[model samples]
Target: MSLAGKVAIVTGSGRGLGLAYAQELAAQGASVIVNDVDAATAAEAVAAIEAAGGTASAVVAPVGPSATAKALVDAAFERYGRLDILVTNAGVLRDTVLWKMSDDDFDTVVDVHLRGTFTCVREAASRMREQGEGGRIICIGSPTGQRGNFGQTNYAAAKAGIVGMVRTWAMELKKAGITANAVIPVAATAMTATVPYFHAAVEAEAKGEAMPAFFRHDLGFGDAGDVAPLIAHLASDAAAGVTGQAIGVGGDRLQLWSHPEPVATAYREGGWDAAALSEEFDAIVGERLQSVGEKFPPLPEELQPPQA
Candidate 1:
């Protein structure tokens, strides 16, 4: 993964997972463009990279806007003469239930995550196409989008939209030699620590308590450094042939996920009327509700049963 001649731009690289990715990419010999909304933070990241014997520069611009995304991409080419990798990792959280969530809260999350990723990817893809060279586009997603969570309807929708974007872009951009992919990362970062349930879940896992199977896949409390390797690999030339994929990176778990499944339906020669449709819906709902009674599989011999 030596990216000696490549130029990588990572948005929101001032801190957290974005910073970690930028640092690791730089360490691997890529000249990095550290973009963040905060000028001081971006400058700090640039200074740190330079101090570590890596080439980097700061670009203080909000990446949520299309104009800002184009400017950021232009700045990278202006400084380094080329852009090889674009990591759309900049995002913000505005968590609230549907009823309590304001228009501003919902709009902010969608604008930052979904629209922002679109802006960056669209701009970078154009440049990559013009240059006639292959490039990588990686969007950061979350488990909340894969499996719904309380107080995160807006966040989940925005994150899930990334998967759709990646899939469509991979198809449209494949001919142009641009690879599009999404990484759903669960790491213990500033965002996760703010949620009490997430914090407790992580503590319970560390204490070796009998936790739910879902919690075993919880990525909310893992080290930020743990996520960079996957991003680096995806950004490298080695992963050129991989596209239109959604990868999950969590503690002791790295897996691929599929989209929602469609239910099977009985079809007739003539389409059913409204009354027949209603009857079918009722039967389907009743069968699904009844299926909840199925018991879990037995645990291994060494493990004791969970106490109620």
Candidate 2:
């Protein structure tokens, strides 16, 4: 995936997964723009890349804000004179159940994850369209967004919203040769470590304590570097035709999932009366609700602890 002469912008590249993506892309010959909320860390990452014989520049801006996102894109164009790839990886985790979750918490998560992604993609898509050459937009997503998790209503909602954005953007930009997609990654990072339940599960396993069956299986706890390869590929010219898809990258596994399932159901040729409509709607809703419990069975005793 040599990106020689190409310019790439990676948000939250100060450390962890974003840093890994920046380094890998730079190594493949892309002039990388490292964007991060922390000026110091951003500078350090850029300096490190330069020291390693890679081309990079640091752009310090909080990506959650629209103005800042525009600034980050402008900084990339100012430095490199072109924008080829935009990776919206900057995000924060505010874990809380729906009942306990605060408005601020919900807003913050949506602002950073969903709104931030939208701002960057909006700006980048405009530039890419103007450039008249194809471009790539990659949004970082999570499994919790696909399969709901306890105590992460806000996070899950934001992530799920990202997938919707990807699909819509992909369709909207297809004619312009711009591709929009998402990468759902399961890696060990500061955000995951901050969740008490996740931290305790890892610790318990390390100490040889009794653990859940799910924990016993390899849960794809790889280093941040593990996630960079897939992102690099998606951002490359080789994947130009792939868009509007959600791909999962965890450890050595890379898989794609269908967003919605189709099923056979009753239909009415003509408009039905209120009473008939009600009966049909109830049956459809009931069938769907019952399938949920059947598909996702109850957790085992060890894994059924109270969520944080």
Candidate 3:
């Protein structure tokens, strides 16, 4: 997936998945603008790309539906004189059950993930229109939004909202040659380390200690580099026609998710009264409903503590 002569802006690219995306794109010949809230990380990412014989610059700004979002797009133009790809990858995790989640937590997640995506897209789309060249717009999403996850109400809702926005952008920008798509990634990064067990394992590995049993199976899929190929492909001319869809990516797996639609319905001649619904509810809708959440499998007994 050669991106020769192209320029890209990848938000939150100072580290982890975002860094992988930026580096891969640059490695394929695209000049990159690395965006991150942390100045040091952003600079380090840029240095890494330069060391790999690629062109890059860093932007340290607060991520949100604010000037910072537009600044990312502007920085891309400043560095390369054109912007051809925009990846809204900046985000933060605020995990907790809905009942225990605070209003601030929910708002903070939405502000960074959803609103940030919108503002960045808004600026990039406008510039792409002015340049009269279609561009690639990729939004980073999460599976939590597709199949509900425990303790991720805010993050899930924000990711789901990103898909909706990208769908609309795809339709509206098709004639202009723009493609908008979402990637639901599963990679181990600082964000996922918020889970204590995952963090402990990362620390142990850093010190060359024996790892937990699950580290070779479920946890082995933590490499952020595994996600770069799909991102690079999507940002290339090869995927010009693939838009308005959510694609799942992790390890060696790639999945295309179905868009929402009416799977089953019942029509009542008089628009069903409460009594009629009481009689037909199960037959009409309840019976067709699928499972709505995800669950983690239990660890093997040997991986657990000794019996009390």
Q: Give the candidate number with the greatest TM-score.
A: 3
Q: Who is ahead in lDDT, 1 or 3?
A: 3
Instruction: Order candidates by TM-score, high to low.
Output: 3, 1, 2
**Candidate 3 error regions (>4 Å):** 194-220, 296-308
* Per-residue lDDT of candidate 1, residues 175-227 (tens digit): 98889999988776777656554545445545755434444444323555668
lDDT of 1 at 64: 84
Better of 2 and 3 by lDDT: 3
Error of 2 at 110 (Å): 0.7
Against the reference, the lDDT scores of all candidates come to 0.82, 0.83, 0.85
Backbone clashes per model, in order?
2, 0, 0
Best lDDT among the predictions, by candidate number: 3
What candidate 2 gets wrong by more than 4 Å, as runs, is: 194-218, 268-308
Structural similarity to truth (TM-score) of each candidate: 0.85, 0.83, 0.89
Residues 1-308 of candidate 3: C-alpha lDDT, one tens digit per residue: 68999999999999888999999999999999998888888899999999999999998997895698778888878878999999999999888898999999999999999999999999999999888989999999988888888888899899999999999999999999999999988766776555544554556546766556474445444457768989999999999889999998765567799999888977989898999999999988887898777555566655543344
Instruction: Give the residue spans of candidate 1 off by over 4 A.
Output: 198-221, 282-308
Tell me the TM-score of model 3.
0.89
